[model samples]
Target: MLEQKGNLFILSGPSGVGKGTVLDALLKDYNDICYSISTTTREPRKGEVDGEDYFFASEDEFKSLVKKDEFLEWAKVHNNYYGTPKKYVDKTLEAGQDVILEIDIQGAKQVRDKFDGGIFIFLAPPSLKELESRINKRGTETKDAIATRLENANKELEEKKNYDYLVVNDQVEDAIKKIEAIIIAERCRL
Candidate 1:
């Protein structure tokens, strides 16, 4: 009788804020939400698959896609490119499947302008000190890289006001619970 339309929910924050961990737990619990995959020009990390974790692309290929207007939102971050594909997100939403994008603040801004009524959620760390410790524990970054990330984290934190919701990721389970609540509340909204 009625056509169903999906709402777009964007989860974004600074690097090392545990966005992936929180999203993984949330996805495990929610069966209806679709996680939109991002395309990136960066090299894949260990254990990352080509199409699962990210659609890894070369700089040239990424630029080609950009030229073709294939991305809903794209941004250059940390010396590499990342983008959300327009077609996939549009198709899934049109099919009445809720789509979630875990992205950075820059890309989130781009999506905000394009996707009206999108629920923007910003994930934050408990503190800068704790965020640095989390990054250090990863051991994936050089000292210089860690420093740069911390610097960028400050700038990203300033943009939290742009989001409709803010979740501090002190614990992964707690973060997932809060996000789940948001999803439920939004779904119930008239």
Candidate 2:
């Protein structure tokens, strides 16, 4: 039997759609799947670790990486640059370990264009009203920032058809179960 090549799973959605929260729960149960850590220019939130949560870089440093073409895909969203390193992802996938990229909608589109095979899953909120409520409860964004996110979310939801799966994040546990099922089914595919 030939050794199976690793699969790429892209989980993306609009901001404030609970993508981060759902990912936190989903990743805790997996030891084999490699969660791709992205590099970004955004400041770390309260308890986010530098290397674990994200490789936080300065604007100049991020620009240098872009110029070097080190990133598989990178995008400027909400005034911060977020990118995935091509080297790390290539190495992990070649080793036969699955990779899950928890990226935003824009980055996912870029990655989809550059890569041939990947399971694109879009995490969605139950409704726009609920999404706004969740963002407000986070207390992380300013009023203006929240507005911008809401505006962007409206547009992103329109792109859901492009994804292979849409997991609605109305309840965290339920959403996690759905994603887990997707992973299990994908792994068993002949």
Candidate 3:
């Protein structure tokens, strides 16, 4: 049997769609899949580690990377810069390990333009009302922030048709199962 080339899977969705929760569970069960850590200009939040959660970069450092074209995809989101570094992802995929990237819609679109072969999966909330509820439940955002997020969510939901798969996150377990199936099916393709 021939060794298969590793696949790049991009997971994106609205802010409150529980992408993080589903991904955490998925990673716990899957050993072959690798998570791609992104770089950001935002300050590390609460318990987020420097290299694990993200590569925390100063604005100047991030700009230097941009000039050097070190990112597969980068964008300014919510007033902070976020980008996927090209090195680790390229190295992982070349080594035949599947790499998964969780990014926003803007970065996903940028990836689409550059890497057409990657699998794009959109994690959608069960409903907009439910999405709003989830954001509220987080209790980390102000009313104005919540409103802004809802507006952005509305815009993102429209892009679902462009993605290869839509996994509605009504339940975390079910969503993970669906995404796992997607990975399996994609891997099976010749």
Candidate 4:
């Protein structure tokens, strides 16, 4: 068998764009893929266990990791620092597993700058209005946060050209198939 080339899949989209839902479905069905667990400075949410939802860290610990160059990509959003742990990804890829990093566009860009051949997939909403509505419908974000996300969505959409694949997620199953196709095509390229 040919040696499997490690694929670092950077999946990014605006908040409330169903990135999490698509990722959860993909994880449920894709055995060869592993989700990247990011380290965060934010406190764990209710029912979210440490090392599962995230590797929760103190602000000092996160800063220490930053200084030690331990992250593949790190960023600050709304005063919280979130970053991908480099060692886990390296080990997983070395073991020939496909690693998926469901990160933001900014973090994705940082990964792109560092890793030469990883695949980038951008999930886009069918329309800006629809995207905003989805964000609003989630009811997790405050009105101000929703507005901020809508504003950010416009900028994020402009980054489609930077990605290797752009999939509009108007339909969940269709989007999954598209993502599955991309993964298959990438595997063939190896």
Candidate 5:
């Protein structure tokens, strides 16, 4: 018998919504799910490994892959190119391993348009004030950058209406449980 293909789950949220933390926890407990690594033209940060954190590429290489249609979705953000490659995702699913794509709103939209069956979950902060606090706590961005991110996050929050599920990340464990429930429910659907 042919192996059953696995499902695609796209998790999206604004910056500082703790999507990464929740995802990390989920993956730690679930060995069946595969996290899709994105390719980027931006330089790797300290301790970020190639092919694990991101597939770091040069401008020419990124452009070359774009032309060859190797990406499921690609976008230019903050003047850097980032994209999800199609091959590994396809192969993993073919081998019956579930795939989780942690991407931005633009890339999520692109995936939604191209792939009709995937689950799209939007992760929202408990409140804008909480979101602001979380972003500030990161201490990585300048004030101006933080303001820009907040503005963009407002726009992204609006897109939640288009998603299949809306998860509020008030507590990390609660959010992960909600997502786990969604996955179970989706899997049960005929």
Candidate 6:
């Protein structure tokens, strides 16, 4: 049998859609796959490790990276800048370990443009009302921030047709199975 070449998988969705939760469950069992840790200009939240959760950098240092064009995709969100460092992702792929990126909708679009052949998955809520409910349930954001996320969620939903797959996150296990199946099917394609 031939050795399999790795493929990049981009997971994108609006806030409060449970994207992280689903990925967390999947990662628990699939530890061998590489997950791209993004770089961020924002300060680490409570209990967030600088290098593990994200490559925490000062705005100046992030700007230097931007100037050098070192990011596969970067964007400013909620007054903080975030970007996917190119080197780690490239190295992971070269090592034949598939790389998974959990990014925002815009960042996903940017990666899709550059990596047109990569697998693009868009996760969606069961309904707009349910999404609002989920955001409100989190209790992590201010009123204004929640509003901003809902607005962005609407916009993100508009781009769902652009992705290679759409998985509605109504149930956690079913969504995971769907995503796992998609990954398995994609691996067979190449």
- Model 6: per-residue lDDT, tens digit, 38-126? 99999899999987889999999999999998898999988999999988788888778888888888788888776657889999999
lDDT of 3 by residue, 57-110 (tens): 999999999999899899998899989998878888888899998887888898
Model 4 whole-model lDDT (C-alpha atoms): 0.88
lDDT of 2 by residue, 1-190 (tens): 6777888999999988888888888989656678998899999999999988899999999999999988879988889998998887888888888899988888899888877789999999999999999999999989999999999999999999999999999899999899888888898998
**What lDDT does the true structure give each of the candidates?**
0.91, 0.90, 0.91, 0.88, 0.89, 0.87
Clash statistics: count for each candidate? 0, 0, 0, 0, 0, 0
Pick by lDDT: 4 or 6, better one:
4
Q: Is candidate 4 or candidate 6 better by TM-score?
A: 4
lDDT, candidate 4, 1-190, per-residue tens: 8667578888987767899899999888877788988999998889998878899999999999999989989999899999999987888898888899888888888888877788999999999999988877778888898888888899889999989999999999888899988988898883
The order by descending TM-score is 4, 3, 5, 6, 1, 2
Local distance difference test, candidate 1: 0.91
List model 1 lDDT by residue over 1-190, tens digit each.
5677788999999999999889988999987899998899998999999878899999999999999989979988889998998888899989988899988888888898877889999999999999999999999999999999999999999999999999999989899999989988887788
TM-score of 1: 0.85
lDDT of 5 by residue, 1-190 (tens): 5667888999999878988899999888766678998999999999999989899999899999999989889999889999999887888888888899988888899898877689999999998889999999999999999999999899889999989999999989888889888887877677
TM-score of each: 0.85, 0.84, 0.88, 0.88, 0.87, 0.86
Question: How much does each candidate deviate from the true structure in C-alpha RMSD?
Answer: 2.8, 2.9, 2.4, 2.2, 2.3, 2.4
Residue-level error in angstroms, candidate 6, position 182 = 1.1
Model 2 TM-score relative to the real fold: 0.84
Clashing pairs in 2: none
Backbone clashes (count) for model 6: 0
